[model samples]
Target: MTPAELGIGIVGLGSIGTTHARALRQVDGVEVRAVSGGAPGTAAECGWPGAVRLTPEDVLSHPGVDVVAVCSPTASHAALGAAAVEAGRHVVVEKPLATTVAEARRLAELQHERGRLVTMVAQRRYEPDYAYLKELAVGGRLGELRLATTHVHWLRDDAYYAAAPWRASMTGGGGSLMNQGVHNVDLLRWLCGPVEEVTAQYATLGHGIEAEDTTVATLRFASGALGLVSTSTATPPGAPATVALHTSAGAVELGQGEVLRWNLPGVPPPPPDEAVASGAADPAAIGVAGHARMWREVVAAIRSGGGHDADAVDAVETVRLLCAIYEAARSGARVRPGELR
Candidate 1:
């Protein structure tokens, strides 16, 4: 079928769900066939004219829906994703594909066996500077990978969590690390390669919630490189996420989603547009450009009827990484990535 025939059906009308719908709507050939608001006929109640697929199964089974975008909460991902795949629909998960690594792997394997397109949202990969950094490392111009660091120190007030019922628990909500910093976790693995082990420490110093408000973890990459990841919702004045890559030859730093510094030998400086993306302090502050960029990749995969670049085939490792950090924080012992998978 042509790209114009690719109809998108989104489940979960939350912020991410809204973001995906808006992004898909902006595309030329794609159509928003229907949306499920996690209830019966809520899609039509919300004025969705295509089809009122109030339940996820309804959307997945709808004849008009060609791709199923799972924008639901963390806990619902594996089951919902499995349902979409079982129904033979293309699947796109928001982020942190599944709460646990094992479920994530299982879901991806099922999609693979079914020959369906499936991907996890890692929007930051659309940033040109990030691509430049990865290109440098792959070209061996950045020399050996030495150290990698990512910081997501942002604040979310009580109202932010209150507005969304799934913001702080292991079920729907997760601490700063799982919910907010999972993107950076994906970036750490994508840019720095696999993580062998992780040691972590965290506490609920800032919020009155059940999860940690602050979290810091040290990583040992399989490539013999050391890494650090810091994410928190406790900082009074939230700061934009930052990432730094140190190699044997030089270093590259990205502050607020832009390249603050690049000093590798022989490689030319990144283009100016590389810094266009930035993380906002508020949850609703996300820019649609990144979402649009990532969605375009999904659309392209649908058009080709084949491969996908951002497939969550390896996303299980990132989830495993976060789980290890949480386990290490609780048990106070360095943990391997697969311990809690």
Candidate 2:
């Protein structure tokens, strides 16, 4: 099919939905044909000329919408995705896939049974430094990875959490680790391999919400590599969010869109100032332009009868790991991956 022939529908007109819509407008062979949400003023703000404003159900059932992008709240992801798959439309859902592993697994099974494409938005993996890190780790440059540590200390004020009631609720969405740090977690798993077990501690440090604001977890990967993940919304502004890896051969540090250091044992560490900057590496320029790239991949998969890169099953694994972490924290005992709800 030609570029003009591809029709797209965007569900949820929030910040994330806006990002996907804008990216779709820039991608070749795709059109942002419709948007569905109850957000006041979203129709005007989204700026899709001649775009249909309808309920999510209406959007999914629209004949013009060949691809459905679900950017709605985490709680609604499963329902929306199932609807799209039932309608035989290709789907791209934002992270977590669903609020629970069971829901995510169901979506995966349904999509598979219906022969439809379903993908999770894992944009961070497309970043140059991260892609390179995955390459190095998979190539054994890290030499049987001994340890990995991920820290996300970014600040999100009370106002930010209060922007939407669902921001800090386990039912509506989740806390810092699930909502914000899940991307890092997904990247960690993507680069290091699958998680075997988890033990965690969680607290509501600065927020009045029911969900956790700070979380620290220890992970055991199937490859026998150990990992430490620390994330919180309680940090002061300007604190750097980073992930560092300590392997048998050396260490690597990732901070704010750059590889801060790539040190090999006995080899002098590279100058910190000379580390590659992430902001300078635009995914768009490289033809992996964020959500647009995801859309393109979905289109290709549909046409070629191939599977999506971040399919629902893959996302369920991430969600399972997260659930295990939360459960372990609450019980004060190590949680195995298979034990997650």
Candidate 3:
């Protein structure tokens, strides 16, 4: 189908949804035909030219909308996705796919049965440095990977939680690991491989919420690689997002954006400043743009009649691993991915 003829509907007008709408508008072959959200005037704020305000159900059922982008709350993803699929529209859902494993799996199955693309928004995958790291890992440059670690530390004040009550309650999709750390978790699995087992510890240190503000997990991968993940919403401002890999060949440290250091057999580490500058690479380092690139890949996938770049089926594994982490922390015992369901 031609880009100009693609009709897209956005199902949420939150901060992320607005970003998605803007990205869609920027894409050559897509048009933001409609928008639905609980917020007042969200559709107008989304900046879509000819966007009509409607309910999610209305957006999905609208004959003019060929693609549905589900950017609603984490808890509502599954129901909205199912609704879009039933309407015979391709779906792009934001992260966490769903709040639970069962819901994510059901959505994946339904999408498969309908022969429609159901994709998850793993926008980090489009980041240049992350993309490069994925290439290196998949290329086996991290020979016989033995250990991997990812740290995501960012600040979220009490007011931040107060802004959205659901942001701090487990029942409402709260928790640092599930909400803020999900991207890192997904990235870990994507770079390292499937996690076979998980043991985690969670704590509520700063925020007075039912959900945890800090979490640490130890992972055992299917390939015998060991992994560690730590995430917190209480860090000071400007904390670096870091991921490191240790293999037989040596180690590679990814800090900020660029590759900080590579002590591999053949690749020598660049100078310190060069390493820092390179490691501090932004998600749009190469100018492909983050969400835009992701959308482009999804559009290409749809045109080719194949799976999305970030397929819902592959995302289920990440959700499974995330649930395992929560379970392990609560049960005070190691949990396996298979046992998550």
User: In candidate 1, residue 120 scores what lDDT?
Assistant: 84
Q: Candidate 2, overall lDDT?
A: 0.78
Q: 1-341, model 2: which lDDT tens digit per residue?
A: 34345788989977778778776766667777788874656655555676788888989989999889998988898889999999989889987788887888988898889888888898777655676677777776667788998887766677777778898897787788888788788888888888999999999998799888889999999989899998887776525557788888888888755567778664433323222222212212212255565676777777778887688878888888888888899999989977665
Query: Which regions in candidate 1 have their CA more than 4 angstroms from the true location?
Result: 1-4, 38-53, 274-277, 338-340
lDDT per residue for candidate 3 within 1-341, as digits (tens), equals: 33446788999876678878867765777778888874666655556658887888999998899889998877788889988998999999988888889988998898889989998888777666777768777787768899999887866778878877888888777788888788778888988888988999999987788899899999999999899999888766626667888999898887645566688887644333222221111211222246777898888888779777578898888889888988999999989987766
User: Could you tell me every candidate's TM-score relative to the true structure?
Assistant: 0.92, 0.89, 0.91
Point out the higher-scoring one by lDDT: 2 or 3: 3
In model 2, the runs with Cα more than 4 Å from the true position are: 1-4, 38-47, 238-240, 264-289
**Candidate 3 ranges beyond 4 A from true positions:** 1-4, 38-46, 268-288
TM-score of 2: 0.89
**Candidate 1 vs. true structure, TM-score:** 0.92
Best by TM-score: 1
Give the distance in Å from residue 9's predicted Cα in candidate 1 to where it truly belongs: 0.4
